[model samples]
Target: MSINPTESCLDCGTPLELTIAGQKKKPCPKCGAYRRKREYQ
Candidate 1:
């Protein structure tokens, strides 16, 4: 399956591009803190 090419931060809801596979978390460029993927609901 293919993951979404981009995801938003769970905390700040900031959208980030997925550069690597299996990445669960990423540092928010705006907040400067780590954020996890939000559930698809």
Candidate 2:
């Protein structure tokens, strides 16, 4: 099987890397430090 190409971080907009483990919802690495999305506003 192959991972879907649509997988990505909603915050930083980075392409999410995948493995045999599984897909999980994780904070964006580029914006992981900031918990709030509205912080930039």
Best TM-score goes to which candidate?
1
lDDT of each: 0.66, 0.46
Runs in model 2 deviating more than 4 A are 1-5, 19-26, 33-41
Write model 2 residue lDDT over 1-41, tens digit each, in one string. Answer: 65444445555656544323464545667766323222111
TM-scores of the models, in the given order?
0.51, 0.34
Which regions of candidate 1 are displaced past 4 Å?
A: 1-5, 22-26, 38-41
Error of 1 at 35 (Å): 1.9
